[model samples]
Target: MTISLKYRIALVVFVLQVAIFSPLLWFTFTAYRDADLQQLQTREDVFMRLVSQLGRKALLTAEPTDFQLFIAPFSKDSHINRIILLNQSGIVVASTAPVDLGGPLPVQKNERNTVWKTSEIANATEQLGAITVHFSRAELDKKVEALVKRGIPIAVAGIILSALVGLGLGSLLTRRLKALEQATRRMGAGDMEVTVAISGNDEVAHLAQVFNEMSGSLRSQFDELQQVQQELSFQAQHDPLTGLPNRLLFDLRCSQAIATARQHKQLLALLFFDLDHFKNINDSYGHQVGDAVLRCVAARLTMALKDHNLIARLGGDEFCVLIEQLEQEQEAAAVAESVLHMLTVPLECEQHEFFLSASIGICLYPRDGDDEVRLLRNADTAMYRAKAAGRGGYRFYSHEQTSSVQERTSLEQRLRKAIERGELRLNYQPQVCLTTGNLVGVEALARWSSPEFGLVAPEKFIPIAEESGQILAMGEWILDDACRQMQKWRRDGSTIPRVAVNLSALQIQRSDIATLVRRTLDSTGLPANCLELEITEGYILQDADRAVAVLQQLRDLGVSIAIDDFGTGFSSLSYLHRLPIDRLKIDKSFVQEIGSTSRAAQVAQAVVSLGKTLGLSIIGEGVEQLHHANALREWGCHEGQGFLYAPALAPDQLHLLAPFKRLP
Candidate 1:
């Protein structure tokens, strides 16, 4: 299907040369032979004229012998095969051939012959009888044949020369083309150093030079592409935020380590770590500062572990470490403590220093797991146990911890299906006006009534929901349900003035929370003024600026906002005025010890004084017993709720309490 470039060029040249010479050979042969024949004819005509002049004298005398002598020399010419002289009487007066001397004038019949007829004048006075002469063309024909024979060799030489020249040109062209072809093949085969040589300033040479430049350009681009691919590969395996091995790379290396440890019958320790209360850092500071702290932690980890271990950021503030060839399990604990001490030195970002702590879980090879997944999982479970054991510590993976995690996992699974199965309900807790001792509003609390667990506590599943990212949906449902219930209560001629719903940190951080709240208010036909949304102090301060912005949007809708569990976290009192909050609910911990000479009671009294000073309403939460109520009222708390008056009850059971305000 494909022809060689060399042969193709040769064939093309040969055909062109033949085409040019074929026409040239024909034209030269025809024109040259014809011109030579014409020249011979002219010579014969001159000789015939000379014969006519001399024969005229003899013609006038009417003497045959004189005419014969005059014309005899004419016949002696080489081109003259025969010559004849004629008189006016049409008889042959003289002839080069003696046989026709007394015969009538011979006819000039041969078409190839040169014949001339003329009449002569005697003494230029009287015209002599016409004297006709004829000359033969055989000699001119022979000369033309000689010329044709001579031109044959010349034409053959010309055709051969044309072919040779075409072949030479084609060879030169193909040589340059072949060089480029070879270079192209070499470059295609990944040889970046190959280049074509430019031989001249012609178009072909210019093309070759451009090709060489393109080769260099392609090589440069190829090298750059390779470098980019390498960077991308590295990025895929390592965390972009901290430049540490990412989860995927960690898993791969962990697997290899497990295999190697098994083969050498060596002990391997995997340390799973989670930054303690990391969300609080993101809350008080920002994610930027949180990321900086994580980077600093990674740097510290790398410095402490050196090249003997594999360290990885397993996403967020969680990192993993694989320490191989551990002589004993205690070595891992020592390493964990060393790393934890290094991390506790306090990381600084944006002129803010953070003292951080990490809960580390260690799982040893052959004791905890024989593989990567089991080892990583077991270590993570133990790390959570360490976190539960009050973080800033390390724990070894054990069978007991694994069972605990299994139970938690089962609980998480059941909780996920709880919402869809309608296993959740809202319980209303009355908020009493402390001065009036009358009900002002009610707080809606979410309670799960799962058939499998039978009244599981919110404290247990709330953390699971938060960690598993289910809190957002749950928060939305709670908001919508609370608003709807408040609307129903108003329609039922109940005197409830307002309904408060708890919003999780995840809910407040969502951009759509305002839209969702507005939609709930509109659909439930609940006035925004009668709906109070409560968020905790620490949660709101996570991204304080954005939280303030979102809270402002809710406030714009005429909704009341409150800070729940006040004094438990940053207190964040400096920005309390900046936040569009209307109330502060004293945390139960403080209210539990109220009226006692305890620090909690003092903090509770201070919170109430602070709320009043800031022109905000105060509500003491979990207020039980008569003394607690007297203490909250003395502190100028405007509202209080607890088991002292009544506990969280169902809607039907709420009517058992005395109606107040607008109860119909």
Candidate 2:
């Protein structure tokens, strides 16, 4: 609805031209009419003066013929349609149009006539008659009409000429303004790059220049902010070091992958991998080398997986792989195997060769577990199982494995609330002298009585605690409670030697184990020698040097280390010497078949002999039958604990589990 500047400028010029010329044309007509009237009056005056002189003689002594002669010129000159002359007697003497020759000029003015009158007197002041001259205005009217007729066309033509000239100038000036207007419109529509081509030095041109400058500045600023936003967005989801998706992004991708596989009715796998011996590598070389190895591993994984799978680094040498659209569940094993093969290629960093291998555990959708957390946890548990078997391979989760994983998850959830719910308690199983059946010590066992599940076995939930990293807290709690119970028994005057508490590999791995032990003894007011620490051979020999250092550090505090479930692990005999092991408890499987000529019974006999040769105390677990205890005593086993003597009893029922020889 806007009027363009081109037409507006033309309209202004046209209006100005009309305003100036109208007044000039009107004044021209008025001036011409006034000059013509003045000339006519002068001519009439001169003729009248001449006629009055001639008429004086006629009036005084001559006849009407002389008056007629003077008046005849007036009629022929066309200055008058009628002329009149009057004598001193106040009567008309002559006239140009001779109607009455002396009619006294009719005594009135006429609409069509121009009249002039003058007085005639003698030289000495004598009174004389007045003479009046009459002339017709028809000729003056004709000239005024002619001038008006001629000037009208000229005025109109001048107006039109001014309009064309104005249009030409306006178009030339407004062209740049139109360009600026277009540019402004584009900028309003979010086009910051829009600019005008300014050519002139007028105000419009200057305005266009400023607009271009502003557009450039806005474009520059917009680009900078856009780049910054992109960088921030990328950094939020990516690992800056490996440039891989972090845990948060991995979870998102996992959810998406699950949804996609579900929609397509296909199977997918989630693989969780942890580098074997990574910590040892970090300790051997330096952190820089470790970082280099991690980066190299990431590169190798990326190359191996390509676009067929989603790979992410889940922090600290742990990585996850998501394989989608799997036609067969076995495809997951192939992907995992390829990853293992890729990682096995030794990495040479800083002129030193570093060997890398990973343990990968796979959980397939609709088979192992469903949700992201369940899938991730299942894969991690399977990974730990793979580590238990042997490193440097892949494992596809089985149904039993999945059930175990679920049980672990459920147990962990319940165990976290166990202390608050008062479901966890220590049951002391008495250890007796194998020969005389006298009590030597007691091993504290943890029992969970869940309101929902009833009595759950320790074997089921203990491994769950170890895998979930809750064992550290559970171990500390057990030690504190066991030490306190031992002190209580002492106050009640019991002769029990020591109270033994079991430790997991996770507990042994901590540098704070000594501190935890010391704090527990100090808080419970129990002597360090009365609180025994038990660990599995498999766990202790995993990192022989670290375990030795840790166990010796505890032994230096007056606490003893007993190897539990001996003859079951692939423990090197040298580890026994390295470790300050004070005792060895024969594995229960070996003691069950003690009387039989079974390999298990022979292994138990060998273990008892090994403990004797090493000058360490030996005990037997799972001693159920009289012959089992007799066989252990014959094998030189110093002590035993199992159902044959008594089941684990509560603190107040220690008298029920009182040490006595087995009834025959």
Return the top candidate by TM-score.
Answer: 2
| Full-model lDDT, candidate 2 | 0.81
lDDT of 2 at 414: 92
What value does the lDDT take at residue 417 in candidate 2?
A: 86
Cα lDDT of model 1 by residue, 359-474, tens digit? 99999998999989999999999998887787799999999998899878988899888889999889999999887877889999989988977898888788888877788888
Candidate 1 RMSD computed on C-alpha atoms after optimal superposition onto the true structure: 10.7
Give candidate 2's error at residue 48 in angstroms.
Answer: 4.4
Model 2 per-residue lDDT tens digits across residues 1-664? 9877787898898888888888988998899899999998887778777766776667666375766776677677655565565666666677776784656556555565565466473335544455566567888889988997898788879888879867977887887877888888888898878889886788988898898889899889878888999988788888887898988888999998888888888888899999986764564445787888888888888888897668899999899998888889778888888988887787877776766788989898978888899899889888876875678888877767766666656778999888778899999999998776678899999999998778999977786677567777888888889999999999999999999999877776654889889988888899988988998887654556777878888999999899999988768777787789799999999999987878988899999999999999999999999899888888788999999887888988888864374531
Instruction: Give the Cα error of residue 222 in candidate 2, in Å.
Output: 1.4
lDDT of 2 at 664: 15
Candidate 1 matches the true fold with a TM-score of: 0.62
- The global C-alpha lDDT for each of the candidates, from Candidate 1 onward, is 0.83, 0.81
The TM-score obtained by model 2 is 0.70
